[model samples]
Target: MTTDFGLKETGYIAPSFAEILDGVEDDYRTRLGDDIALTSNAYLGIFARLMSDASYDLIQQQEQIYYSGFYSTAVNSALDRLAGNISLTRKVDAPSHAEVVITTEGEYLIQAGEKFETEDGLVFDLTEDVITSKQSDGAFQGTGNVECEETGEFTNVPANTITLFANPDEDFISVTNPRPAGGGQDYEDDETFRKRLIMENAARPGPTEPGIKSALMNLNGVKQVGFIDNDKYKTDEYGNPECSVHIYVLGGNDDEIAKTLIDKCAAGITLAGSIVKEAPDATGKLKEVKFDHAQQHNIYVKIDVSINDDWNSDAGVDDIKQAICDEINSLEMGQRVNFTRLYSVTYDVNGVDDATIAIGSTKDKLADQNISIGRSEFAHCDPGDVEVDLIGL
Candidate 1:
């Protein structure tokens, strides 16, 4: 017996306006005979061109909907409504913030709400006023914190760069940021928002572990989250029940994290440590409640990468270093930094032929040990902590 195998059609070539016009003209010519002047008449040609253009546009629009339903605004809007997610085009922008330290001289009273600027024109406003006190040595010193005026990644100004005070004279006051600003981000891209919506849909029923993790991940500026069940911590220091969640966050307000925890966590479960809260006393005066954050532990990642001769450029070396830092920063609490994965990422870089990574040793392979974090601590890796060396240059 002979059997026939059917193959599916896999290619489509959309007809252009000219192709459609030619086909219509040819059909008209066939029906009316070649003696008729199909192209010479201005009115007939105009009508054919108009019909062809309309048909081509309609086909193109239909093809867009057929190929990617989400590409259609109406379709995407309907899906977002069903998924209970905001449209990717309308996602909120996250603001960047930094702590600006203002130093003044000669007992000057730097007023609250004072503004400072970087040479490149990034603005920062004072959160509170400060009084510079002159010591017996005749030197004045004071410090105050400031926040960036705009919401953007560029607002994360460097230390000592915000020296020009917008108000008052720059001669009397000096501005500096002890740490880099963080948390500023643009609205979510289509792919990221789509993935988030899918995760949300899969976890929408109730508060399962995956749901909680998804919720936390969806929060702005939260990079990674690690959850420890009751079994992980048998008891607290005082013999109380202890369950912990570790979060590695990049930007957004710290206070917002507390609020998110309260909203997402189950009742009667402790947040492992103290958290800041505001409450009113019997006198109706607001009182501040403070809690300690999870302790941070730093891990040093040392990578030596071998680059091909053609790719032994500064940009290639920088890309390798940046990749290592991004991987380390993406780690959550209690997550281990696998040396194998790190090595793979290094080799995956465009110009990296091979790489040898050591956690903290000059040796090629330091037993391939991975860094582990505790329940009460999150792993942190400073860009400075990541050491990358270019070899075979």
Candidate 2:
């Protein structure tokens, strides 16, 4: 196909700044006479320079316009527009949810907007109103649905972390979440969206493995997804049933996840998991669905750094820890964590002269080697677990 705007077989081509300026000067010389001097500060020379700049800008805009039509090169709204043509939209940010325990002295009503908080100031609000009855221990206990005031990472905390109510109530005594608040999601960024769009292009979107995973990933708050299909006539070594597809999802709404699994699965493909739930089908018929939560494996790291005067001992330690956590947490399920990769993150911080790193599953047994993760397990590192030993030079 013949393409305008310098489109070549290889890719889009645009004239360089020097070429544009030279062309303008050449045209002026050719049209007017050779005797006319085109000095640096001359009006003609200045006018030619401005014209070249304007022309170059126009060409760049044309380049952006051409690339916007393609997925690999588009950005922001342009990428969204292209993906929409294929029936895929970007996932929006989702709030983190947790099962909270409301503890009160007597019969009390917990309103939906009422909030519970951690000592660090992370807050969670109740999702619904509930009336608690007095328990045998003399404290009234009730309710479970509470979501983080914000979304994305750090929202999923450990058990019993939430202990305070946002606004004190005479009827409300204390609050604590027995389970961590999870399913917090951030809006899908352009790069992640581009990757999903490319993968979805490879297959049709229903009853297939890729389709099932893509659908689940699109759900709010879902972090990582692992797919295992035991197609043989007998039970697999992993204990999965014959002719079944077992999914390990890290985070997401239970009901939405169950429904997606039921909808995308082919008939006779048994969904394998210990957890079971009732999900309504498209026609509003109740159907039983099953799936498993991905097992989370903690990775511990110890870093010994030799640094100069520029390193702030207090803040640099936290910076190094956060860098390591982000790098390891970005790995997919079953991906091996390379010990050498940790050193790269440490050196990325300023004032680092030397770094030695080791990693392991248990805090006691750390070694400088690759840690292999299992198929159903997601590897993670906490900033606290990262021990930074700074040696002053």
Give the winner by lDDT.
2
lDDT of prediction 1: 0.60
**Model 2 per-residue lDDT tens digits across residues 213-271:** 88887777777789888989989988998888788888887767888887887876788
Clashing pairs in 1: 274-291
lDDT of 1 by residue, 87-148 (tens): 22324566555566555656677787888788898887777877878767666766666767
For every candidate in turn, the CA RMSD to the true structure comes to 8.4, 3.7
Evaluate model 1: give its TM-score: 0.58
Model 1 regions more than 4 Å off: 1-91, 97-112, 116-123, 127-146, 153-183, 204-219, 229-234, 237-250, 262-268, 279-299, 312-314, 361-367, 376-393
lDDT, candidate 2, at 4? 34
Local accuracy by lDDT, each model: 0.60, 0.83
On the 0 to 100 scale, the lDDT of residue 130 in model 2 is: 77
Superposed by TM-score, candidate 1 places the C-alpha of residue 276 at a distance from the truth, in angstroms, of 1.8
